[model samples]
Structures are given as structure tokens and as C-alpha cells.
Target: MDTNVITPEGYAELQQELDTLWRHERPEVTRKVQWAASLGDRSENADYQYNKKRLREIDRRVRFLRNRLSKLRVVEYNPVQEGKAYFGAWVTLVDEDDQTLTFRIVGPDEIYGKQHYVSVHAPVVKACLGKAEGDEVRVRTPDSVKLWEIAEIRYGLAAADR
Candidate 1:
């Protein structure tokens, strides 16, 4: 398995989700499944079937989380990363059309549900890595190559600034 890279905040979030699933959700679903099974006929027991499926899904997720968490390396902000686009850096870009876009470079595990988070493995991030503010970056997409200028780079203070 590939090493899972994650930000400190993202790691904490995943840990919290795992805890919730293990301590609360899984137990609750298991209880429901047991109660439904006690009603005797499971062939047509909707509650039992539903809860059983839910339990399996929960267990699968728990297993995945456990394995993933073990492999995850939480990335902390480094002072040396200042003034350049690196992992965990908040970068603002301007296109040739003067359109502004801002996003933070984070690991794949952190990008879900966050529109402003870009995966570190993305082509745009690959282009932005080691680039300082005012540097031009080119990202090759399936259709065309996109050009952007790094307008700003900030680390550690991104949340406060936003």
C-alpha cells in the first residue's frame, strides 16, 4: 500500500470519525440488528436485513480507517516552507484572464467535502510545488495546458486569514 500523507488537522478529523463509528454507530447498529433478529423470522425482516447491511458497511469502514490511520503520516507546517507553495500551503493563483483562485494543497484524504482543498498529487499541485509567489506555473490537463501565476503563498496562518 502507498503511504498515506495527511495534514495534522485531517488526521485528527479521521481519528474522530473512527472513534465515533467504533464507539457509537457500530454499537447502535449492532443493537438494532440483534433486536430485529429476536423477532424470529429473518427472511422477511426488513429491519434485520437493513441493520445487518449497515453493520457490515460500518465494520468495513472501521477496518479501512484502522488500516489507513496506521499508514498515515501527519504533516505539520514547517517554517522553512514559508514563501513557497508546498504541502499544506494556502496558495492564491491568477490566470491569464485575471481570474483568481485560491486553494490549499493537502493530501487526498483531506480533500473530500472541501472545495478549497487540492490534493498534493494533483497536477496543479505538482506544478506549484517549490514555486514562490509571483512565479508562473503550467499545468497540463487532458484538453489543454493551463497557465497560472502564484499570487500569494501562506502557511500556518491560512485559517486565520480566511
Candidate 2:
């Protein structure tokens, strides 16, 4: 399997989520399932059915968290490597049209709920990696090639690492 690299903060966030799911959410769902089971016949009990399905979903997520945590390696800031972009770099880019966008390079699981976050495995991140501030990069899509200028770069904290 390919090794996954994540910032320290991202790792911590994943661990925190895992803890919440296993310690809190899982037990709560289990209890609901048991309570629903006590209400009526198994085939027709809606509560039991809902809670059972919820438990299965929770178990699946928990297992994914456990497996991912085991496989991912957290990348910590070294200060000396801050000038150019890497896994944790917060970069701002301006398109040829002068429209600017900012994003932090993160792992796949951390990509949700953030307007400016990009997965390290994404095409934009791959194009931005190893680039320094003021550098220019071109990203090719199936439709067209977008040319972007690196307006700024900062090795900012990953949410879990901070």
C-alpha cells in the first residue's frame, strides 16, 4: 500500500474523530439499538432498524479511522524547510485573469468543510508542491490548461497539528 503523509494537526484531528466515534458515538448507537430491540418484534421495529443501520455505519467509519491512522505518517514542521511548498503549505495563487485563490495542502479525509483546502493527491496540489512564492505553474485539465502564479506561500498549521 502507498504510504499516506499528513500534517501533525491533521493526524491529531483524525485521532480525535476516531476517539469521539468509538468512545461516544458507537456506544450511544449500541445503546439505542438495544433499547429499540426491546420495544417490539425485530422485523417491524423502526427504532431497532434505524439504530442497527446507524451502528453499522459507525462501525465502518471507526474501522476506516483505525486503518487510516495506522497507515498515515504525520509530517511535522522543521522551520528550515518552510520557504517552499510541501504537504502543510498554505499557498495563494492568482490565475492569469488575476482571480486569486488560497488553499492548504492536506490529506483526503481533511478536505471536507473547507473552501480552500486541497488534497495533496489532487492535480492542483501536485502542481503546487515544491514551488516557492512568486513561482508560476500550469495545471492541465481535460478541457484546458490553467496558468497560475504563486502569489504567496506560508507553511501554516494543519488543523490537527496546531
Local distance difference test scores for all models: 0.90, 0.84
Off by over 4 Å in 1: 1-3, 157-162
Return the lDDT, model 1, position 140.
99
| Candidate 2 lDDT over residue span 59-148, tens digit each | 999899999999898878778767787877888999988999888987776777766778988888889889888899899889999999
Q: What is candidate 1's CA lDDT for residue 113? A: 88
What is the Å distance of residue 93 in model 2 from its true position?
0.8
RMSD of each: 2.1, 2.5
Each candidate's number of clashing pairs is 0, 3
After TM-score superposition, the amount by which residue 1's alpha carbon in candidate 2 deviates from its true location, in angstroms, is 11
Q: Give the TM-score comparing model 2 with the true structure, all chains together.
A: 0.88
